[model samples]
Target: MNRFILLFALCFHPFALIAQQPVPVKPRILISTDIGGTDPDDNQSMAHLLMYNDKFNIEGLVSSPSYGSGTKGEILRMIDLYEQDLPKLKAHRNGFLSPAYLRSVTKQGRRGNAPYRGYSKATEGSDWIIKCAKKKSDQPLWVLGWGGLEDIAQALHDAPEIQSKLRVYWIGGPNKKWGANSYAYIAENFPGLWFIEVNSSYYGFFSNNNILDSVKTTDYYDKYIQGAGYLGKDFKSYYNGEVKMGDTPSLLYMMDGNPENPARESWGGSFEHLSRSPHVVFNSATRITDTVAFCTVVEFNLKGPEIVIPQDSVCFWMETPYKNAVQKWPGYYLGKGRYGLKYVPKQAEIVSYRFRSSIPNVDFGEGKLTVTNHWPGKVNNTDYKLGANWYSDKADPALYEGKIQGGKTLSKWRQSVLTDWAARWGWLKK
Candidate 1:
């Protein structure tokens, strides 16, 4: 009778674990990374992905770095390591995608951040993203953004139709610091896209409260990762083997639960649906009286007397007070008797700025921006506030050692997640 009951329960479900919602057998994913850039954390994340690649139907690996000299060659370097470890990885799981295919799909995106307009010309990486997203499939193409949103912006600019077909999960904090222009473009233009902007929640992955000593960043690599395989050795080489895989949270979000439902508790941390982001436009220079939420993406649309210029790229530029010196941001010329410039304030203070144009007669003169606190908790937060359909950490997140805002959501699950990865790491242990 007990055996019959056990069999009956097995009949009820094939896999012991089930997701929050019905998901694809293997979620289709494409990764856009700054693997070779200033942050070595991405390299650690890439290593982790190749080690557990069986769970995903990996599509494209594009190098879309806004800062530093990240290139497709860096991705190829990791694939080279994966090639060596492929045999071992396949021993544990069947249907592991070939390294050759990963190489084929890998491509280079825009070398730098987009101009103030947000998008520039198309690259191999951006074109590949459009191609993959447009493929006829029941599941949406999940685009994991480990760095800048430049290629994603360029891809969307080139093909707006793909917006409906793509699901974006961007590791926001530091990456957003560098790719503000591209991020602003997407938030303002693509309001209905399925996007999860993990601005601060991702901070939970490397941080936690009351976690096992074995799972801490300082001990985890030595305990589970260092001697595992080729990927482990490569992971240890970065950040002195301390786990700072900030990009991996996006990968975990897809693997741990029903990614379609962002509010559900998962290893990647739960997020809230953000319907509206602060997007304000001004015809003239703004003043301290014209206040907006901190981290707001402000646009200045100027209509000057008609003037001709040889090139649009270098037509106009704005000078703003940043830190101790003045930093210049380029402005774009929008047709139909208009020019435009976008700015995202990072702190709660009155910012002053001036605009100059190559046309000589066209000038915005000067302006002041009043950035106010509206985070509901902390202040001067990341500038990753996105538009409608975008999911992010709650304003008041569970605090983990003085940090909060979507952080503890994942930290609470750190022990469980690390335990699972520990088992996987054992698979590579001969």
Candidate 2:
């Protein structure tokens, strides 16, 4: 009886079962980017991905330019830099794929946006995606759409059988607008398709204001990336020599999370499920407001030794608010060492107030004021006309409502990305 009890416990014990299983590693990733485009941020993102090549099984790198001027040549240029730095990266960790192998897989997709229906015609990139998906593998191929989803839509349209084997994570705020037809086709036909549409949350990577002081400064880039290796050298050249890998979050999400479930929190920001196809619901809202009023108070505190101030000499100066071509009100003294200003802001105005006092012995301190009638969700059509700035008409409410696991903030997610970056550079251990 004792022997029977021991055998049963051994069979069902949770700890025993857990101990027998192998720890899962990162997922297989196929990056589809529009590098070499008008926005150079994609190049920075590619450099970031190559630095951490050991973390993922990178299957393909395809250039799918939707709007900007970019192609496979730019992808090769970035990879050439990666080839030069591969030796140094390999010294820190194993499993770095050969540069030649990466080059062999890099291909060009549709040069511009897809037709109104999404799939235009077969391209090397789309065909490659189909081939990769159909290959026998225990893991699913994660098609990361950093640029647009034209190639992905083409793959699905050509080989619908691979739908079950593929998982898509599209960076779809403005990119969605570029590939509207393809996105619409995929959504209309594949209701149950396994996909995650990341719109505003991806903005968290670059928009995180709470990163470490070191990361915010030039010292971090100089130490870890700039002049560290060939890859680092190429990375510093992009974004006016700043670390702005905006699209790196797509891979960061797959690096350490449950690949089967995107809803779980990971280094990549978490997402919520969509109730309907986002394409069908997206429409443009008209501009409802012409002017927005802003007010702020500035104080000058004379802390140190006092100095004489010439009467009527300009004591303070504030620049006109941005997009204030037709200023309704300009900066003026409110008396008692305080100042206030009001102005009409241009459409989709991201405005800030700046002021300086001429008081010789006083330190100009900051003050606060409340703003009213500031339209929060006003659509700026001018922004759309410039580039990919299409906002969904009926925006996905889940985007605002969803929360990452552990209630993680963008700052925390950025830290995770920085940590991995540091680890790859041999600054920190794996």
Best by TM-score: 1
Candidate 1, residues 1-430, lDDT tens digits: the string is: 5998668645653222333333446899999999999899999899878877888999999999888899999999999998988888788789777989989989999887787778889999999999999999999999999999999999999999999999999987667656777888787778888999776777777874543323677688888986887887887789988888999998888887688888887778788887666667789988778887555667778887665543245568778877788776667766645787766665457888889876767888888877664432232233345455788767662443244466777776666677777887887777
Q: For residues 1-430, what per-residue lDDT tens digits would candidate 2 score against the true structure?
A: 5998768655643222221112176678898998988778898888878877877888899999987888999989888988877777777778888889999999889888764445779899999999899889988898888987889889999998898888888777557645555676676666556787665566556653443323542344666665566766666677656666668778777775576655555566665555543111101111223222211111122223333443222344434343535211222343454333222222223334444555563333332223232212333232111111111112334333232111232334565466447656553222
Q: List clashing residue pairs in candidate 1.
A: none
Q: Give the per-residue Cα lDDT of candidate 2 at 406.
A: 18
Candidate 1's C-alpha runs over 4 A off are 1-24, 208-214, 280-295, 300-341, 345-388, 397-401
At residue 334, candidate 1 shows an lDDT of: 68
**Candidate closest to the true structure, highest lDDT:** 1
Give me the displacement of residue 398 in model 1, in angstroms.
4.3
